[model samples]
Target: MQLNQRINAFVELGKLLKDLAENETIAQTILAKAEAENGWFTRENILFSLNNWAEALTQANLLQWMSKYNVELLPQESNEVKKVAIIMAGNIPLVGFHDFLSVLMTGNKVITKLSSNDKTLLPFIAAQLIEIEPRFKDYVAFTEGKLEHFDMVIATGSNNTARYFEYYFGKYPNIIRKNRNSVAILNGTETEAELKLLADDIFVYFGLGCRNVSKLYVPEGYNFEAFFKAMYHWKEIIHNHKYINNYDYNKAVYLMDSFPLLDNEFMLLKEDKGFSSPISVVFFEKYDSEESLKKEVSKHSENIQCIVSKIGIDNEIRFGETQFPKLWDYADGVDTVAFLLDS
Candidate 1:
């Protein structure tokens, strides 16, 4: 397919997703399949993911994002179509969609080894794409067994699996992403509305996504009453059995160890210096000065995916925009498109 053809097909697919989000029957159908496949994919969350993608895949956004790259400079016809195998992560709904889109948009064939936890949604979307543009049928494939006959690979996994990926696929041109988490910086001046929005950053996807804020950096003697009050808006998430179960387990561990914690009935807050927090838990640390905080964040840059703040730190994502990454907002700060195009 030509580059324009590929871009148009995705834009159409996005429009279809938006239509599905508003169509009760089709939305229910997709939601039912997702729920049956993965219990964690509640209808609300599934639709949220779908709507976000719909917003992201618009023709305008597509054009604007691609405009930054010199698409015309890319090889019009490659001597050999390289196969880029994508090992997806299932931590959140459609977490690997960006990589899949990147590979296809770059004129490479994609062999997706879908994570079992999220195997249904992407393939369904891919079917829609193929239906819209038959040429896509020749470019996309899914795998169940071991990946083979691929020229390059892009893998997303935890820190442990990343080691295995490096040991195995190290010879191939690859982007092996390891575990990373986001954090928020609070200067005690945020309004209740801003803090409320920050709740979405922390609670969305039940905090399973890398963009979810797992930790907070606050000034010394920062008050918690306002933050907790704002977080109450998402209190209904406690009704989720899985989330409550995790809350119960982690809370019990902390209690048994006599570790001090602040609880809001649904989530637990602990004072610690850690980037990766358990589900239903968030860790916070006190910073003495802005310079020290920046130094600390920079020191742990490899473990951090994004920094959410209103203090105007360099590259800090806006208060609530952590999860809504633009197409060019490459994962792990690595340009997947550039990698694929160069390969």
Candidate 2:
């Protein structure tokens, strides 16, 4: 299929996903299956992620994203269709959708090794796409066992697993992503509304995705009163047994160790220099100077994903916008579309 045909099929699939949100009966059924497979895949979180994808898949958005590349030449330049193998990370629902979309958008075949945690949602959506345009049947495949016979690869996993990916797939052209966490820089001037929105950046998808802000860089004398008060918006998140269990466990461990912690009966804020915090906690550190903070952040740029700030930091992602990334917001700053097209 041509690029436009592929884009049209996805556009139709987007409509189906958006419509599914309105059809509570169908949406609930899908959510139930996802929850059964993974306890972290709560109905609300799945629906939130689905809605974001639906909104992003518009014709105008797809066309605009494609306009950045010489997409029309894909079919003309290559006689052999490259079979791209994708190892998806299931930290959040449909986490690997972007890679899947990139492969097919470039007129290449995709063979996905689905994560056991997120096995249901993507396949169901892929089925819907095939129904929208049957030509996808020739391009899409999912394997339950070891992957073989692929021309290129795209893999996402923790830093440990990334080493294995590089060791094994190093011979092939690939984009391998490791662990990354987002952080927010608070200058102590944010309004309550902005802080409330920041709550979504921290709590949405239960803070499983890399884009979720797991750390904060606050002014040296910043007070926790306002930040804690604004975090009340996601108090309902504590009601989830899985989340509460982590919160209780982490809180107990910290208390036992006599580590300083700020608790709000739901989330815990700890003074830490780390990027990846425990699920029920957010790590934070105080900064005395903008120059030092910028230098420090730049030093760890490899481990940082999104910098949630409105303080004029270069390439900073605004509050509540990290999770709503557009089609072209490639993870790890690696251009998936360019990678696929070049491969």
Candidate 3:
């Protein structure tokens, strides 16, 4: 298919997912199809996150961006079509979807190895596309095998798993999706609504993804009330999940036994000396000037994604837009499509 033609199909594909989200009947049917097909998604946060991804893509202006960006990124020579083996990260909802969009936008065939934890969503999405237009099956492929014989590869995983990816996939020309974390910069000028949105960014997907706001850099006189109030909704979520409940319980015990943190009732605050975000942490620090913040952020450039906050800063993507990535928002900040097509 021609570039714009394929893009138009995907735009409709995105609209289908969006309508599924807004309409109870379609969304529930797809969810049921997914459950009948993939076993694990019947679980909690995984299910919530999967459903949320469909809502996010169309709701977040990504579909609109795709319609624009896909044709713009089309390869000059059709023979140079790059076939990419995509290893998705299941930690967050549809984490690998952006990379999928990138490959497809560049007129490449994607052979995706879905995260075992996320098998349900990707397959169902593929099924929907095929149902819309079977030709998408020609553009995308699924493989349970470890990626083999591809022009390039993209893999996302934990910090330690990233090392393994580098060792295995890096030998070939590839972009290794490493253990990255996003932090928020709060200037304390945020209004109540902004704080609430920022809280959604932090708590969504249970803060498992690279873009999740695992840390925050705050101004000296920051008011914590705004954040707590916005995030209060997730309290029931925290209690209902056994793993998060364990984390909260153990975190409280550790603080009591070992030491204390600059924290309150809703969330704990701590500082780490390095880049990777703690599994369930919300670090806070006082920033005096933009120069110092820039220096610190530059130091961790390899580990950061879109900074989520209302602060007037560079690279900030605003609260509640953390996972709402668009065509050019490449993972690890590497433009894979540009690398392939330009080369």
lDDT of 3 at 98: 74
What TM-score would each prediction reach against the true structure? 0.98, 0.98, 0.83
In model 3, where do residues sit more than 4 Å from their true spots? Answer: 27-79, 221-223, 262-266, 274-280
lDDT of 1 by residue, 238-336 (tens): 999999999999999999999999999999999999899999999999999999899999999999998999887878988789889998898889998
Local lDDT at 207 for model 2: 90
Query: Which whole-number lDDT from 0 to 100 does residue 233 have in model 2?
Result: 82
In model 1, what are the clashing residue pairs, if there are any?
none
- Which residue pairs overlap in candidate 3's backbone? none
Worst 10 residues of 2 by lDDT: 71-80
CA deviation > 4 Å runs, candidate 1: none
Off by over 4 Å in 2: none
Quote the lDDT for 158 in model 3.
Answer: 77
Residue-by-residue lDDT tens digits, candidate 2, 49-148: 7888899999999999999998555755445688999999999999999999988988888999999999999999999999999989988999999999
Error of 3 at 67 (Å): 8.8
Model 3 worst lDDT run, 10 consecutive residues: 38-47
Clashes of 2: 0
Q: After superposition, how far is residue 271 of candidate 2 from its true place, in Å?
A: 0.8
